[model samples]
Target: MRLHPDIPPGPLHEKWDNCRFSNTLVNPANRRKYEIIVVGTGLAGASAAASLAELGYNVKSFCIQDSPRRAHSIAAQGGINAAKNYQNDSDSVFRLFYDTIKGGDFRSREANVYRLAQISNAIIDHCAAQGVPFAREYGGTLANRSFGGAQVSRTFYARGQTGQQLLLGAYSSLMRQVAAGKVTIYSRREMMDVVVVDGQARGIIVRNLLTGELERYSANAVVLATGGYGNAFYLSTNAMASNVTAAWRAHKRGAGFANPCFVQIHPTCIPVHGDYQSKLTLMSESLRNDGRVWVPKKTNDL
Candidate 1:
């Protein structure tokens, strides 16, 4: 089989707009005919499932945690990046894309990176509409903070608990879908395998963590938004339960893993002191807004 990203053909700025206008649209009445199984309820999974259900598709969202809000995304304390340019520092979609590409050593795909920069503002708007309680300025406008590797202040945060607040916003949206009977959520269920039928992913086999029973679920499509595999390092900052089980199962079932070597290191993680330490705690990157990072001149310097 051949792999092709099938990126839309157009100039960088126009590609996304062209694709959106050209893509096929499912009729609203026919949306209910399809069932989508979304594995993992992190920001991506929860938002995708909720949005699809709101568009009239039958969605079954699963999370190993007791609640979608407990997903490892809640550990993200730094803040989210956007190109809103509220600081009037000339930040734009292209600048955000360029900064990210350079920050990643230009290894990321241009199309994907540009798309991320484009939709970032929409994400903030959506979250705000859901009452995310983002930090605001004295004038009652949204606040912005400067993070590393960026000249402009484009990071939007909710005090020091940005991720927790964002997750709550997404959880509220998911719950709204559930209350409307458009989405069914299953917590404490871990995806153990992807069920591919006739070379197409058709369903999944999940293990109920609470019951220790394996259950098979069939769906028209399967969406794997499981979080990263940082815990594969055995002592990273990820939650202990945030293993790569779902991703590994999918890989074993035929899905290809990309850039497995690209692991992000948080420079502010707490130093490991003993063998008993199971995970590293992160010092929020937002601290850099006021604090400076430096090393001691002597080995014993405090």
Candidate 2:
């Protein structure tokens, strides 16, 4: 199959608005008739599941973990960057977009990155409304900090547990949907394959981790927010359970894979000597932000 991003036609700033305006709205009343399957319960999956359920769609959310709260997103110890301009440091959507594009070595799609930048502030507001305890100033304004890559202090965080708090916010929304019967969550089940029907992804086949039984579930649509393949590198900062299977399966069944090499490596890490697959002990990302990363002058001195 061919891959076409179908980027919105317009200027970078107007493309997102045009795209949003052109999106065909699903009938809210008929939304309940559509069963949407969301694989992975991390921030991306959980937020999508919660939002779709809120829109009156029936959602089936699956995860490999016994508890949704335990997704690798919780292990994140840094802050999230937004173009809120809370610091009054001249941060803007375009600036954030440019910075991100430059950080990606100019390889990222400008339209997509621009859209992400435009929605950055809204993301912070939504998470805050969800009761994410972000660090704030003494005057009750949201706090900002300088993180890696960006010169401006646009990073908003809940101390060192930004990911944990954000995930909690998304999880709360998801649980509320589950309680209302709008969403059904399947935990401890790993998606073994994507089930496609009529050139469309309709469902998935999952393996029950506890029973070793294969189960097939079909949906009107499927979403795979199963995250990165960092664990395939053998030694990395990603959670141990994080694997490439779900994404690989999707790729095999007609999905576009982009920028697999765009992986983040925490600079402050121990040079552990062992098998190549052995996981390395990484220091907090926030730590290196406060100080410089020191390297040994000679080989094998770590």
Candidate 3:
């Protein structure tokens, strides 16, 4: 594809603002007509559902967790990345985008990475407003830390429970919507498949995990934030029940699965103690900066 000269090319900072204003919008009155279904309670799913409902859409959110709070995102021990540059160090959008692209071994789409970089700032602000109790500096400003290959202190975290804190923020917002009746949250439900009518997603087929009864749900559009299929390895950092069923069913229904083999293995998880060891506990990569990484020279040493 040839580049369009009229498009902005200076930096992502300039491109997002230019493109956002150029996009169309649905009037507030018409926004109520669109019903959205989100089938996951992880950070992505819950946050997306809450934000969508706040925008006046008739939303229905589902999760297999006994509560939305139990989504796999809650298992995330590390923090989220944002480029606030509060440390006045060498942090910036391009660097974060480049790090993510290089970290993923260049398999990720540049457009998606760029957009993630743009919205990352808002994620931090949104979380702060929800009173997540993030670790803060003496001056009461939010604290930052380094993670992985990033050089700057840009990763905002809580005391060894960043994922839990952030998920709570998103969940709080979701609960507010549930209380208002703007969003109908169905807990302990598993999404079986998406229903498409005449080439567009119309609803979904779900199963009540507790009663084992199947139900049909109809909506204008459905969103599958059910998360990744890292569990396909049978032994991974993923939750015990996490599977590719939701995304796989969607793929079979026409949502293309891209880069299915892209898996990033963190190097510092606890070594398997015995053959019966069930799962590995990740000593967050954040610990690597302060702790030294080592391995035995002999094959039998471990």
- Please tell me which predicted candidate would have the highest TM-score against the true structure: 1
- What is each predicted model's overall lDDT from 0 to 1? 0.90, 0.89, 0.85
Candidate 2 is scored at a TM of 0.95
> If the candidates were sorted by their lDDT against the true structure, best first, what order would they fall in?
1, 2, 3
- Cα deviation of 28, candidate 1, in Å: 0.5
Q: What is the alpha-carbon lDDT for the whole of candidate 1?
A: 0.90
Tens digits of per-residue lDDT, candidate 3, 1-302, equal 23333444546556767677877988989988989999998999999999999999989999998999999888776688998899999788888888989988887767668778878898899899998888899999999888886878898889889889889989999999999888998998988888999878899999999999999999988888988777788567777667799988988888767677886566888777788866677888888865667678798886
Candidate 1 residue runs with Cα over 4 Å from true position: 294-299
- Checking candidate 2 for backbone clashes, the offending pairs are none
Candidate 1, residue 115: Cα displacement in angstroms equals: 0.7
Clashes of each: 0, 0, 0
The lDDT leader among the candidates is 1
- Ranking 2 against 3 by lDDT, winner: 2
How far is 31's C-alpha from truth in model 3 (Å)? 1.7
Residue 4 C-alpha lDDT in model 2: 83
User: RMSD, each candidate, Å?
Assistant: 1.6, 2.1, 3.5
lDDT of 1 by residue, 13-132 (tens): 888899999999999999999999999888999999999999999999999989999999998887899999999999998899999999889998899899999999999999999999
